[model samples]
Target: MYRVIQFSTGNVGREALRMIIARPDLELVGVHAASPAKIGRDAAELCGLGEPTGITATDDLDALVALGADCVVFTAQAETRPDEALAQMCAFLRAGTDVVATSFVWLVNPRSADAWLLDPLREACEEGGSSLYVNGIDPGYSGDTLALAALSLAGSADRVVIQEVFDYADYDDGEFTGVQFGFGLPADAEPALMATPGIVASIWGGSVHLLAEAMGITLDSVSDRWETWVTPTPIDCVMTKVEANCVAAVRFAAEGFRDGRAVIVVEHVNRLTPAAAPDWAYPPEGRDGVHRVLVEGHPGIEINSHVGGGEISETFAGVVSTAARVVNAIAAVRAADPGILGVVDLPAGYAGRVMS
Candidate 1:
């Protein structure tokens, strides 16, 4: 069993802790949290593990790393401040602990990180002999791995498209519901303000680009836009201007090409509220989370995947699944090149266990 140290005590950390408890291949070695309320708690208790495992939380960074953990799973707020987070991650890697993080900073572009961030971390990992990686549900899996796996069904294809739609009302995060989707905003608010600049692109762009590269298709052009409107009331008990309750619709499309020939196209949508269309699935009703993968091949094939959604447990599970994949990818940490690494570099059918 791999001894793992988890960073932070937020939703992601808690979710990961739950998976470790059930998986016999991994063990929870320690937990580091900034919250004083969580600092002294057992890792298992945080996830309702039924009994304490004696692995209490700690605020002491040095002491936490000294536990001789095989790896560290970081789900901290570095996503809001990626540069600093990347540097800190490098420290853990250099200390001989393989690093697995879902931080947004490292997810952006491994090369874009500051010299101070990558230099020491790379050296440390090289000397200590370890590896590091960053990932998340949206950019990491639902958007990338699933899409790539579907593409393999066709021997050859001229184009591929992956689409995802999420109901905003089902989401309970204050920041996500209020700002990101413009759910509770006034009816008179401008529609342009509903979609935050770079936020939507940051989430899906990486996946689209990665898939294109893996397919050997050069991306000719990419475009993204957001649409928001006030709903008459709220459909399906949702309340928003974009829809009856408060729904914001955002769509992204990317056209790929090879030598000036269009080879692929990808389009996706993030719906925050309910829609008037009878076909549009709304959360709390029919299938809330649904994904459709369509391949335009010699014979044309399509696969429909229906995923259920409900409660905080489901939300935590989706987010935690991404972290779990990163942890399972830890065995190959040593083979990972210095600097930031993404899911694309990850081996296919990775077994979600040891990296090797």
Candidate 2:
């Protein structure tokens, strides 16, 4: 079994901890609790195992690094503190720990990643002979891997699209949704970061580029677009209360253009309230928390998949699956060459476990 350390105890990290404990090929060695409230608790208390894991959660980053575990399932909140997360990853790498992460999203396409971001990770990997893979549901497997895998069934290719139809009401972190996402903001006010131009492109753009590269297509430029939906009446959402006529959710896309036309695309129709946008496309199952992949080519393909299943909420499904994507990549990352990598760099039909 490969030794493992779960970094953070938040939504995503909690799920990663649980999986590491369950997998026979993996052993839970340590956990880095970001919140002081969880600092001295047993790893089991945070995950839903109903028992002690013998391993305690701590905030001591240096101590965790010193353990020199085989891999660290890093699910820390990298959106707001990317530099700190990058530094932390480097520390783990310099100490010889492979990293399979859902952070520093820009690294999803490490090849085209900005030098300021990619160089340090590369240097760290070289220094300690470790590897790093950044991933998640949207920018992770849902688009890059799963979408590409479906393309093989197509005889010829025209345009490809991955759309996210998710409800954010179960996100649990209301303040995060209210403040960062501005879920209930008025129409005239400044919208959430999610509504900002280029934000979607910044996050999902890498996935778009990865898809373009995989198909041997060169994109002229990548662009983004967005649309907002409002509530007809006050609605209670995970974020603040949405007043009538206030913005409740958004639909956006990051597209890669070639020959003056969009080709590879990643679109999202997200709502803070379940029925906010009826006109936007949703999963054929008419459920939230689903990702749809469409390949417009010879065989014309389409797929709609949900994570965590019907009994589970969309937020739980999305975050937990993000954790699973990286957790399942542990062994593959360990076997990879010492460098910052992605799903494309690894062998196909061979990830998700050390052994089936």
Candidate 3:
């Protein structure tokens, strides 16, 4: 059995652990926690499974590697220091272990990060005969997978556009709430936190290029814009305004082009809508706003799909299910030559199932 070492105890890590537990072929080997509170606890407890799995969270990097794990699923946030995270991935690869992660943006856009870190990783994987890949719900499926799904519907096209409109007003996580919809800090405060180079440009920039390459378009240049404003009043919700730390509305949008020709338009908003009565006319966008993917191309065809657009429970369930699919694709992770890797990299014969 392949031993899977989960590197974080965060929400995404927990979700991945659940999938691993349900899959019969895989074994949960160890849990590595960066926090002291979680250290020495059963991996099952970290995942809220109510029981320990003999595996305990550890902070000793070398000890974690000594466990003879076949692969590691990394979800720990390196925050402003992504290089530290990259170093860990390099170490894992060099130690003869494969890795699947969603930490640094370089996992999606390796060209931007210091090649000093990535080059060694590529070399390590080659020498160690191990595979490495990074994917998640947002950058993993929503942007990449969704884009490829739309392209599958097209024959010949000069350009394809994918748009995802999600209601940030409903997101309640503190880490996300602070930057929901691109709102980094108060409008009047010091330079917005989300306006920094990394948050605004680096985050979605990779997705734009990933989509462009999937369609075989060589992008000449890329530009983006962000807007953040407060709601008329406070929104009281479980995760949206409350947990998301969204006091008002936050919106982030970007447009990509090839040689002055528009190719893709993508936008994300936190708390973009207001509360309304149940029977109120919710309009075409739906009550939770709209999560849609629109493809405009030959003969003017548009395909739009949304999250919570039909069934609210199914929409949330889809996120969890897609996360599981991302974990299952761990075995397919491969090193690339300094460019964006998109859904096209996933082979047509790929079944999108758990790796044995």
Candidate 4:
């Protein structure tokens, strides 16, 4: 069994912890908590697993790093603190621990990442002889990996578009839904997170670059476009309330151009409620969400993924899938060559085996 230490217990991190405890091939060695309130708490409690694992959450970084575990599942939020997260990952890597993370989405395709960011990670890998992989559902598997896999059926391709259409009303993250995506704010409020310059490129642009690389084509340039819709009436959801004229829906596209034409595109259509953007794309009947990849070619192909659970909402199921994507890649990452690794570098079929 591979000894594993979990970092943070946020939405994704808690799911990662549940996965670590459930996997027979993985052993939980430690858990790291950023907030003092979480410190000294049992790992099982943090994950809501209803049983004790005897592993307590600690705020001490040095001790967790010194544990010398095989892999550290780093699911800490990176958008708010990219530099700090990068430094923490580097510290763990330099200590000779392989890492699989959902943070640093740009590392989905390391070549597309900034030189400064990539250089230090490369150096850290070389120094510790440990490998690091960054990935998630949209930016990781559903967008890049799955999209690339579907392209194999195409005889000829003109355009590739990967889209994630979600209803955020059921999602519980207030800060993410309201502040980041401008869900509860007015439509005209100073550009929300999705409208920030280069933010879309920084988050989803790597997927565009990854697709272009898979297709063996060079992109002339990358471009982005965004649009927002407001709730015409007051609406309430499990997470937050949206007053009339508040930002309720957003659609954005990040595209990679070849020969002055868009060949690769990553688009997102997120709404607070299903009715908020009735005219926008909707998932299959009875399904809450979908991830789709459309390849415009001689034999155009479209792949749609509908991930839902009986007990949890589709939004939470998406988060669990994101955690599974990274957690399942742990073993492959540990055995891989030392350096910053991308999804393309690892072999196919890292998804964990189902236990009967």
Using TM-score as the measure, the top candidate is 4
lDDT values for all models:
0.62, 0.84, 0.61, 0.88
- Candidate 3 achieves a global lDDT of 0.61
Any runs in candidate 1 off by more than 4 Å, and if so which? 105-124, 187-199, 234-249, 252-268, 272-285, 308-317, 332-340, 352-356
Model 3 lDDT per residue over 1-356, tens place: 56888888776777778767657667888778888999998878888787567888888888877886788887777555667887777778777788877766445645434566567777877766776766665555656676667767777566655555444434445465345333333445554566554465456677777777667878776677666554444555545343233335555655677778767766665443454222222225334544456666754555554444454543354445445655676555533322223345656434445544
Output the TM-score of candidate 4. 0.97
Tens-place lDDT per residue, model 2, 26-83, is 9999999888899889999989898788999998999999998999999998888878
Top candidate when judged by lDDT against the true structure? 4
Descending-TM-score candidate ranking: 4, 2, 3, 1
Candidate 1 lDDT, tens digit per residue, 100-183? 877754353344344665676668778767777777665556556777777777777777766655554445554533455565
Per-residue CA lDDT of model 4 for 1-356, tens digit only, reads 89999999999999999989988999999999999999999999999999899999998889999999999999998768978888899899999999999988888888789997899899989999999999989888877778988898899888999989988888999877567777778766787866887788778888898888788889998988888888889989876888898878888888898888888999999888788888998877877788999999979899988777578889999899899989989888987999999988888887656443
* Clash pairs (backbone) in predicted model 4: none
| Candidate 2 Cα misplacement greater than 4 A, ranges | 352-356
Q: TM-score of model 3 relative to the true fold?
A: 0.82
Candidates 2 and 3 compared by TM-score, better number: 2
Residue 38 Cα positional deviation in candidate 4, in Å, after optimal superposition:
0.6
